[model samples]
Target: MRIARWTVTDLIHDGFVIDDRVVEFPDGLTVADVLARGLSATGELYERVRDAAATPLADIRLLAPLVPAAVRDFVAFEEHVEGVSAGVEGKSDVAPEWYEAPTFYFTNPHTILGPDEPVSPPVTERLDFELELAAVIGAAPGVGQANLTAGDAASVIFGYTIMNDWSARDLQGREMKVRLGPAKGKDFGMSLGPWIVTADELAPYLDADGFLAVRAEVYVNDELVGEDLVSNMGWPFPELVAYASRNSCVVPGDVLGSGTVGNGGCLGELWGRNGSLTPPPLQTGDIVRMVVEGVGELVGAVGAHVAAPQLPRARTRTRARRR
Candidate 1:
């Protein structure tokens, strides 16, 4: 089932997409609500809404599928990491530690935008988009479940959605000099949706090796920019999820991003390959469209850049004398 949230005439609703129409869920029920009950309940919920009155998808405004409980984006594509590193840091080699385990960083969950929304990039000259697939976590067997094995982690995934991890490259480059953050560089905005396609709906696309062998593509201002297969990732979603739960807990509505795809997912990768910016960074009015087979398409428009105010410098002070 394809689940979505949308607004019509100032009223918001939750529904499931069937063909070109949306079947509204009962009042007060949402994708998050269903996910909170666990994936096993989805079959029954679908039966309840499968025959309801429907609305044409074109008549309503789509919203981000759900407000994520938390967002963890991983760098699971080796080519992407190498290309981005070469572009940003003048290095093309993948870090050795990257091969040891799946690594991820938390991104802001509050600023998520839905399809067709405008992204006002933070003061930046290098605004870029990351083509990624995000998995939404469903309820676990019990609250605070931790140390899940890869197989168990797979069961907790509810569905998949397209994501655009909007970035401010210049800002990211500056902050990482301190070895700390991709914070302001990344936290400004993120895009997810069209809708979420439940896991069962995508099972047919899974390869024998357990990778989702789906094609992902991205376009800028209607021009095709990049494409890759999800199976190309160095680590699959199950491993990523399992790593996320190592000594920690994953809750319903937690989103895990598959990071950027290789071969043109972003301008940085292109720069890395060509040794210069070819297509250039995103600008106001540019529309970014991302498609993941069996999932959905997510479209976002770049709005005018919002200039950030300068931060006051911290005063230098000598450490206190030893006690």
Candidate 2:
């Protein structure tokens, strides 16, 4: 089943997106409400609204599925890591440690936006989008395992959604060099939705290798820029989620994004394809659309460039290298 949150008029509602129609929960039910009881509880809710009167898909405006409890985006793709490392640092190899564990970072849940929303990038140029699939964490209260092993990932995963992790390449490149952050560069906004498809709905497509054999694609201004298969990632969602929940907890509404796919999933990778000549980065009015076969699509236009302000520093230049 596909779950969605959208606005019909001045009122916002949570509902099931079934075949070009939205079957809203009779009351003020929300994604959060259903998540609290865990996705295992969705069966009954699905039954409740399965046959209800629905609004036409074109009549309502979709919103971000929910205000997540937290968002953790994991870099599970080796090719993406290697490509980015080489593109930015001129380094061509993945660190030995990177292969041992899945690494991720927390992103701003507050900046979340929905499909068709406008993204105001931090700068007018060098903006990019990452095509990814985000798995929403189910309620952690009881799943028969407290430690949460990779083997138990299926029990805790509720569903998936397509994500466009927007980036200001210049800002990211600068800050990341200091070994501090991708902050300010990545936190501007992230687009998620179309709707969330429950795990059970995707069971049929699970491959023999235990990976979801889904095709991922990114289009900018209706031109295809990137495409890849989700199975290319070395570490699967279960491993990433298990690692995340280790020594901690993952609650309902928590979202974890499968990092950018390989084979030119973003301009950073695409620009580095050839030496000097490259296509332009995202600018105002560029529409970035991401599609994950089972998860659906997310489309957002680059609205406008934000005017950058002065940086706080005691000096303008760093110390010179020794002779």
Candidate models: Cα lDDT each: 0.90, 0.83
Instruction: Residues 40-93, candidate 2: write the lDDT tens digits.
Output: 677788888789988899999999987888889888888787777766767656
- Where does candidate 1 stray beyond 4 Å? none
With candidate 2 superimposed using the best TM-score fit, by how many Å does residue 195's alpha carbon deviate from the native? 0.7
Question: On a 0 to 100 scale, what is the lDDT of residue 104 in model 1?
Answer: 93
Q: What digit string (tens of lDDT, one per residue) describes model 1 on residues 1-323?
A: 88899999989888788899888777578878988887678778788879888999889999999999999999889889888888877879898999999899999999999999999888888999999999999986633588888899888989999999999988999999999889999998999998989998899998988999999999998899999999999888988998999989889999999989998988889888788877899999999999999887899999998987788898997887975
Candidate closest to the true structure, highest TM-score: 1
Which residue pairs in model 2 clash with each other? none
